[model samples]
Every structure is written in C-alpha cells, then in structure tokens.
Target: MDDSEADDPNRTSPRPAASGGWSRLSASRGFLLLWGAQSVSTLGASSASFVLTLEVFRDTGSAVALAVLTVMSSAGNIYLAPLAGAFADRIGHRRAAILANVVLATASAVMATVSLIGPGRLLGLVYPLVLVSAIAASMLTLTLTASIRRMRQDADLTRINGVTTLLQRAPVIVAPVVGAALYATVAPAYVYVVDGLTSLGCVAALLVVRWDAPPLAGPRRANPFPGARDGLAWILRHRGIREMQIGFAGLNLFNGLGVTATTAYVILLADRRWGSASGLAAYNVSAAVGLVAGAALAG
Candidate 1:
C-alpha cells in the first residue's frame, strides 16, 4: 500500500494496516500500552484509596469526613456519568482517558505535596482532593471501559477484561503490606506520591498509544444521547435482559447465611485483628484473584 492509502484509517475495502480488524482489537500495540499503564496505576489507585481514608481519619479523627467522602463521591459518579461518557465519545476515547489520568495524577501529587508541607493544618484539603481525584479516576475508567467494549470479539474481549481483574488483584496481593511499610517507615505523603507517580505511568502509555473512532460518513448526529436512551430502553424491554435481571435479583434476594453471615463474621474478625483497611484489602484481593482465575478459565 502507498503512503496515502496507508494513512487512510477509515478505508473500508482496504482496512487499516492492522492485523485483521478483529485481531487488531485484541493485539493493537497502542491498546496494549494503555492496558499495561492502567494495570500498574490501578494497583496504585487501590492502595491510594485505602491510605487516603486512613490518612483522613488520622488527620481529623472524624469518621464523618470519611462517610461524607464516600457518599458524595458515589452520588457525583452517577450524576456526572452521562456527561463524562458523552464527552469521551465526542473526543477520542484514548485522549479523554489521558486527560482524566492527568487530572488524577495532578490531584494526587498536589495532595501529597501539600500534606507534607502543612501536615494536620491542611486537614480539610485531604477529602476534597480525594473526591476530585476519585472523580477523575472514575472518568478515566469509564472512557477506557468504553474502548474495551469495542474489542475484537466476544471471547477476545473477555481476555482483555481479564487483564484488569488480574491487575486489580496485584495491589491486594502486595499493596497492603507495602502501604503498611510506607506508613511505618516513610509517611502518608510518600504513599500518595507512589500513586501520583504511577499516574505518570499511564500518561506515558497514552503518549505511545493512538486510537481513532470509526469515521462518520455524513454529518454526525447532533446528539448521541437519544441513541443512548434507545439502547437503554431496548434493554429494559428485552426478554433476555429481563430474565437476567430477574435472575440477578433472585440471586441477591437469596443470598443469606452464606453472604451476610460470612461477611459479618469476617468484618468482626478483621476489626479485632487486622484493622479495617488490611482486612478489606485481604477480601478484595481474594475476590480479584477469583475473578482473574475465572477469566483465565473462560479464556
């Protein structure tokens, strides 16, 4: 192929010079770069979440801040998702994702540095920064997940998803002890710094990676939200989805002694022995490991 044709990514007859389109989705060098970067930073993010909450408690001795932080962050996530998802699709997914990563990294770095400078005096800043950083991280996650949905094939997509589940477990397997070591030997400032630097790893990956959405042949829809609504509406009426939802609800409803009882027992045990953070880490790690193993088995 000549240079001009090679440059034309939207060409349908002669697809872009990638492994067949399907393979392209699975093994794109750029995609892999983003994936690897996210995996590492995601590990850092997990640890940061744990340490940040602890840091907040240590600084203020107020569980109220922690509760407020969690609730407000969650509320913001559901409220802002439509906008975040729309914006990502409007821009290039990869680019928006990078922007979100930058937001996260910068927030983490600023908070870490400020915490070191002011110590307890900067107490109010901790939860605010954490909220902003968490929001950015959520936006990044949604953008990346949108891209993942456009994968090569159903099975290959599963494999790609598996990568994340595996990465999620890594922090569980290693980060708690690591966070403890940092808290014991260094300081919370250093723990935040670790997360902030890992965000840079994502930035580096974005630098090397590129993705373009399928070309629009005509004027793009004025707004994609209607189409999005149609999708949700369709799912609402779909028999398959209906059955799945019912099954899911049933499963949740049926979860009894094994679920709540075990969880309660574990929580009490964790509180008495390991402390909440370490105990939660152990559970998440085990869950992540199970998910990864399940994904591998599926593959």
Candidate 2:
C-alpha cells in the first residue's frame, strides 16, 4: 500500500488472514520497533514518576504538595488533549510522536539539571515542568494511538489494542521497585537522566520508521481551537459517547483521589513507621499487582 493509503483509516483495504495471528504481527519490523519503544519508554516514565513522588514527599513531607503535583499534571492532560489531537492531525502521527518525545526528553533533562544544581525547594520549578511533560506525554499518547491502525490491518487491531493496554498497566508493577533501587544507589538526578534517555530512544525509533506527511489544511481549518470545539460538539451530541464520557469522568475523579491519597498515606506510613523507602515500594508493587489482577478478571 502507498503510505497515504496505509495512514488512511477509512480506506477500503482488504483484511489480512486471521490465521497469521501473533506471528504475522511480529513480522512487521516497524510495528515491532514501535511496540518495543513504547514499552521501554512507558517503563522509564513510570519509574521516573515513582522517583519524583518519593523525592517530593521526602522534601516537602506534605500530602498537599503531592496533591498539587497530581492536580497540575491531570489538568494539563485534560486541558491539552484536544489541542494535542488537533496537532497530531495536522502533522503526521509519526512527526507528532517524535516531537512529543523530544519535548519530554527536554523536560526530563531540565529536571535533572535542576535537581543537580539546586534540589532544595524544587516545588516551585518542578510543578511547571511536570505540567509541560504531562502535555507532551498526552500528545505522544494520541499520536501513537492514531498510528496503531496505520501500522497493521483491521484484523489485528483488537489484539494490538489489548497488547497496548497491557503495556500501559504492566510497567507499574516493576517501576516502583526499580525506582527505589535506583534512588537508593545513585543520585536522584540520574533517574531523570534515565527518563530522558528513554525518551530519546523513542525518538530514534520514530525517526527510523517511514511515514507519509498528513495533508495540509487551509488557514481556518489549521487552527486547533476550531477542531477542538468541533470535537467537543460531536461528543456532546452523541448520546452514547456523552454518557460514556460522563461515566468515565466520574470514575476517574474518584480513582485519582484514591490513588493520590493512598500513595501519600503509604509513603508517610513507610517513613514514619517502617523507616525505609522499601516499604513504600512494596506498597506500590502490591497495589499494582492488584490492579493488574482486577483488570484481568474484568477482561
């Protein structure tokens, strides 16, 4: 297929044989690279997050401080998602993905520099950086998700999506443990360094993959706000989508609250009672295991 045809989600292309299954999907080098890159980047990002949480709690010793970080990150994701989508739609998905990862890498590098130079009272700087990283991460997520369909045939989308979901959740199980080990052994600045390297790795992977440029739009259509507004209008107009969005919004609200509270509580408890970072890591590991198990059962 031509590159444009490959990227066109609405193209009337013939489906590949279902019997090929995992083997067929595995044979696609680009897809394999994409998958592996995402897995590594996810793990790195999760580990960095775990380390950041520990650092923030250790420094400030305030649950409110942690809450602020969480709130800012979530706000960035929510507010920027539509704009991110519009951006990916304007640029090709591959370009957008590369751009996002580059931004993430830059952010990580800056955080590392900040940590090394003046680790004290970092909340002032860390908060804004986290917000920027969150927005870039959101953009990366949107681009990668959109690229999935272009990488494989329709028959494999369900399988690929399941794999992607697993990739998203599975890293949590190991990240805290890994982060704790790294945080204990090396300088915390190095943790951000690792995160930056992983992001660069993703950028390299994207660079090697061949992608067709997206079609250009007129000046009016090029504006992100119009597209975002139209998307919101469409979502509101659709009963099923609107209802689903509402349900997920409510679910995520409580989920975010519980997660932040539990994390803060566990960290504090571990520090005050157990007197070690290992306890916090253990709690995170157990929570992640439970989440994975619950998801498996539901599926």
Candidate 3:
C-alpha cells in the first residue's frame, strides 16, 4: 500500500500472513498503548464503582437508593449510546476518546472535592456526577472499539478482540478486592482521587500514541438524530441481528434485576453478619471470576 493509504485511519490494512499467539498484537505499538490505557482505566473505574456502591448503600442503608444510582448510570449508556457513537465518528475516534477521558477525570475530581467538603450533605450530588461520568465512559468505550479495527489486520481482529475482552474482565476480578482494601484504609476522597489520576494517565497514553486522521464522511450533519435513526433502521432490518438484540434486551433486563437484588442482599447480609466491605468484595470477585471464566471458554 502507498503511504497515503497506509496513513488513512478509515482504511483497514490488508491482512498479513497468519501468525500464532499474540505476536501480531504485541508487535503493534499503537495497539499495545491503547490496550494498556484501556486496561488501566477499566481497573480504576471498576474499583471506583465498587467503592461508590458500597458507600451509597452504607450511607443510606436503603436498597432503593442503590438501585436508583445503578439505574441512572445504566440509563446513560442505554439512551445515549447511538448519539455518542455518532458524535465520536464526526470528531475522530482518538480525539473523542481523549475528550471522554477528560470528562471522566473531571467528574472524578469533582466527586472527590464533594466528598472532602461534607459527604453527608453532598451525597445527593453523586447521582448527577455519576450520570455525567457514565455518558463520557460510554463515548470512550465506543471510540476505543472503533479504533481497534484500524489498529490490526482483519485476520487478527478475533485474536485482538479476545485479548481485549479478557483484559477488561480480568481487572474486575481483582478490582473489588483492591477497592475493599482501599475503602477500609483510606477516606472516600482518596479513592476518587486515585480514580481521577488513572483517567489522567489514560489521557496521557492516548496523547502519546500516534493515530492517523479519519477520512471525511462528506458534509457534517448538524443533527445526529438522522444518523442514529438510520443505524437503528439498519439493525432492525437484519433478521439475525434484530432477533439477537431482542434476546439480549430480555436477558439484560432479567440480569440487571438479579444483579441488583443479589448485590443488595449480599451487602445487607454482610452488614448484619460480618459487618465489613469484605463480604461485598467477595461477592463481586466471585461473579467476576465466573465472567472471566466464561469469556475464556468462549474465546
């Protein structure tokens, strides 16, 4: 391929000769940096999520409050994913990823500040901040997923995806344990500070990694709704994909309910019995382990 074509971000490179193991992925400096940044950020975010849920449940002693917070967080991803994806496509994936991380870092910092001033009075602020962070995080995830295709050959896509999936899930397995330890030893403000620092670290990694400019997709649309609508229509038109999505929606609904109920039950049980965050961490770790095992088996 010519230098121009090689430099086009929207163009997928021709597949190279078959390779074994992670040789192809490990050889790509860009993918390595991207992978490291994403893995670290996931770890930080997962740990912070554990801490936040525990704190919220402990503070309010109400399962409803915890459920509300969880709902608000998921709502951002569910409702705004299409819009976020469209926006990221317009801005360039690398730039969008950087912007999203910046927003996430800022939200974490603000939460930390609120915790320091007075956690009891400021607890209400956490809900809005969580919503904002969730939006940014969804955008970040969308951009990174798009970037992965551009970073490797078509033949290596499956392997690269498997590696990414495993690394992402691997963090969760240990994040709760680390989070519980942090919660037991430090103030909540410090936990937020750590989360913010990890986000900044991701931003720095994104900056250092070289990225090709995405090709222009003609004139930019003033409204993203058209693109989102078109995308949804395309999905609906595909019988297999449409059915799969319907199945997933039902599965996720029940899974969400089960997870929420189980989390509340375990936390409450631990509070009454063991009286520590360790119980929550134990539950999370076990669930995460199962998820990782499933991913490995699937891969």
Report the lDDT tens digits of candidate 2 across residue range 161-188: 9988877777778888888898889988
Q: In model 3, which regions exceed 4 Å deviation?
A: 1-27, 117-120, 213-216, 222-251, 295-299
Q: What is the TM-score of each candidate against the true structure?
A: 0.67, 0.81, 0.82
**lDDT for every model?**
0.64, 0.79, 0.79
Q: What lDDT score goes with residue 24 in model 1?
A: 61
Query: What is the Cα-based lDDT of residue 162 in candidate 2?
Result: 90
Candidate 3 displacement at residue 128 in angstroms: 1.5
Q: In model 1, how large is the Cα lDDT of residue 230?
A: 79
Q: Which stretches of candidate 1 lie over 4 Å from their true place?
A: 1-29, 117-123, 149-155, 168-174, 214-299
In candidate 2, stretches whose alpha carbon ends up further than 4 angstroms from where it belongs are 1-27, 118-120, 213-251, 272-276
Cα lDDT of model 2 overall? 0.79
Clashes of 1: 0
Better of 2 and 3 by TM-score: 3
